[model samples]
Target chain A: MTAPLLEARGLRVTRIGDAGPLKVLDGADFTLERGEVVDVLGPSGSGKTTLLRALAWMLPDAEGELWLDGSAAAEIGARVWRTRVALAPQRTALFPGTVADNLLAPWRLKVRHDAAGPDSGALRRALDSVGLDDVALDRDAAKLSVGQAARVALVRVGLTRPDVLLLDEPDASLDGDSAAQVASAVARFAETGAVVRVRHQRPDGTATRRERLVAGRIHGVGDCE
Target chain B: MSEAAGVVTIEWPQLLLAAGFMVVVGVISLRLALGLERDLALATARTYVQLFVLGLVLRWMFGIDSPWLVLAILVLMVAAAARTIVRRAPDAPKGMLGSSFVSMALTGFIVTFAVTGLVVQVEPWYRAQYVVPIAGMVLGNSMNGIALALERTFADLDARADELLALVALGASPWEAAAPSVRTALTAALIPTINSMAAAGVVFIPGMMTGQILAGADPMKASAYQIVVMLMVSAATALGSVLAVLLTYHRRFSASGVFIERGLRDDIATARAEE
Candidate 1:
């Protein structure tokens, strides 16, 4: 019984709304194993984004027991936890620079200061893997279309080399072919690490299991239909 | 009311002429229904009352010339300035009084000290006239800088929430995620000071220089004092903006490096409810 790559126990997020405290996520228990792609399906406002944000420790108001590699998340710290468990949020946020700069952004962070950024060759390959081989490395990222920026964001997070990647509606802006390429890229990611993606589409034939969020809790939806 | 050295003296009665100028403005506002009559009247009243009170306080303090009293007055001025910043910057996160106070106090004390001691070489260093007035100028400018910086920081952070979170998701520290907002805020806050320095003599004579000249001082010496005052104001504004931003930017995040969207609003409410 090897430990799960990433696990959340009794996770709860109580956000303050105009009315008052709104429990966005309550007692969410989840597990991610290596070499597996899990598709998290939920309603439009069923805390899907909140789950991924909570996993990445983006919500300071959130409370939970998170375990990574059999160690408590408290011991690993949020910065380290985020490095190991990256979340590419729903909105494709690209910095105001060339694509190369956006991809190299993770290494530029103080937490990753000691690590060297990927060379141009590695960056080209990462983009190639995400079907962005046509996008020039020196091209301005802000000029990229929504679909291109989304793929670039995926590559950027992927370049961080996390043990688990959480994608929040990553394919929402993507076309059919581009979405397929993204699925393949994520599948390649699952060959060594793991992925938890929130998408409206079906599993894309890569997700090994499917789970849907219901009223702030995770419930198994059997296997991919 | 006595004239000295070619300077025309304006007695208390002469200020009625100045009031008449406001009356002309108020009459226009009333005729056009601009509805500024009340504000004009209140501002006119406050100008007279506030300056009169300040004159009385300065006379008494200068007469006393006690170092303790000087220190106490400076502290009170800084405290009031800090409170004004906290109140003016509506978007600032809670618990900002300490940072505002510390930033204003440090800038006010250090700049005034340098001007009076090293630059002007006032004998007793803490001479109430030199120290108090210089400190008031420094604190007033720095307070505006700090308040503007704080307001800009919070607004930028809220506007760039997604961008900030993206950085955080990429393993950035709180400071790293907030660097852009801080830079933007500091630049915005320092623009007025920069412009004032650039326009000090060519565009207009600064108030200090005008006052010195009107008081029968040599123009060359007045220019020297005005130059020092200009440089001192710029320094105070820059230092105050930096300290205020640095001390308070982390309030946007948690100890675990998470970016709080509402900036401790929930935590504050929870604490209050618990109490």
Candidate 2:
């Protein structure tokens, strides 16, 4: 049998709190396959964001057994692992530049220098796919509205073309139509790649499987209804 | 001691008259309830005592004319400057005394030696009279510059934590992630030195130039020395700021290049507790 696209076992995270070390995630197990979208449901402060950051290797104190395309994360290295498993955090943070500049920001990193950079036409297509067709590429990203910025962020993350997209509430600030566009964007990505989406509200998109995180443990909530 | 060179020496008893001027300022503070009379008196006393001790030490060193003695004095100055820099920047990570000391010692000795050895071309290179004062000046200025850079670096790091994390999430290296904060801190540290260069001899006579003139040196000669002092101070400040940032910026990241916000804070707290 082919290995899953991405897998995590015994994922643990410890963050320093006001009193002492706080155990945020403990022994959380997960798996994703090619062309599958998994929705992670959790209440506030249930370690959903921490789990995604840990999977992306962005948390310094996070430890786990993780594999990507059957290779151990330790063997793959953090830099290469992150390039394959991109994360879109819940809060929208755009670098200081025009929309097009923000979209191409990742390509400028040394780690991404080897990857094929997207052309202008590809950028336009990604924008169109995310319902940002009306927005000008030259517009200052800081001037974009909350919903417009959300779409732009989604498009930015999609342009990187990772094997697994760890999205943290990509539709939190989006309107109904924009939210639908985001769901479609995830669906399109799932057609080729895999997605692990953490959501507080149920999105319009359908997932192949659903799981809820409670107190840092993953509990299966059955397949998509 | 000689008035023929146009030098004016104030008698030792005349300093009591200078003390009268302080009484005027002290009375004003007393009337306004400014609560600065005690600090002012203590500071005045320290100035007198410190200068007297420095004068005795310099006299003794110049008589010995020993390079080892000069080196010892220079090291002592750098150590004191580093301690002051670390103490002034209370918010910076702990155990920075070592880095600051190295930054100050490296830049301080290099710039001072360059000025005295190459520019001034003082005979016997480590002349206590020439080297000690120059080294003190470099350490004094660069100490302030390095402290400012370190403080600004940590402050900007905390303020731009989210932006830094965003870049890290995109596979940015530690240097790439901390680039913005480093740039801002370096700029902040260099501004005072740049402004001093701009204002020298025009807005105000610099301290070194004033001292040379008061010692009966020609105005033109004093101006030349002032120019060299200004340039060397700027160079020392720039080098010290860069070195400080280089040593401390990576403290915000892990060995594998993760931005450890919580870990950094805990480490800082631990350092403080140990202190």
**Against the native chain B, what TM-score does each candidate's chain B reach?**
0.95, 0.93
Give the worst 10-residue stretch by lDDT in candidate 1 chain B: B1-10
B1-275, model 2: which lDDT tens digit per residue? Answer: 23149778877777778877888899999999999999889888888899889999999999999999999989989999999988988877667999999999899989999999999999999999999999988889999999999999888877777777777778889898888888999999999999999998789999998988898888889899999988998999999989988988887677678766644566435434644
* Best candidate according to TM-score: 1
Q: Model 2 TM-score? A: 0.94
Per-model tally of clashing residue pairs: 0, 0
Candidate 2 ranges beyond 4 A from true positions: A16-21, B1-4, B262-264, B267-275
- Indicate which candidate wins on lDDT: 1
**Docking quality class, candidate 2:** medium
Colliding residue pairs in candidate 1: none
In model 2 chain A, where is the ten-residue run with the lowest total lDDT? A14-23
lDDT, candidate 1, B46-120, per-residue tens: 999999999999999889989999999999999999999999888777899999999999988989999999999
Q: How well is each residue in A44-134 modelled by candidate 2, as lDDT tens digits?
A: 8788998998889876656688999999999999887888998888888788899999899888899988787788899888898878889
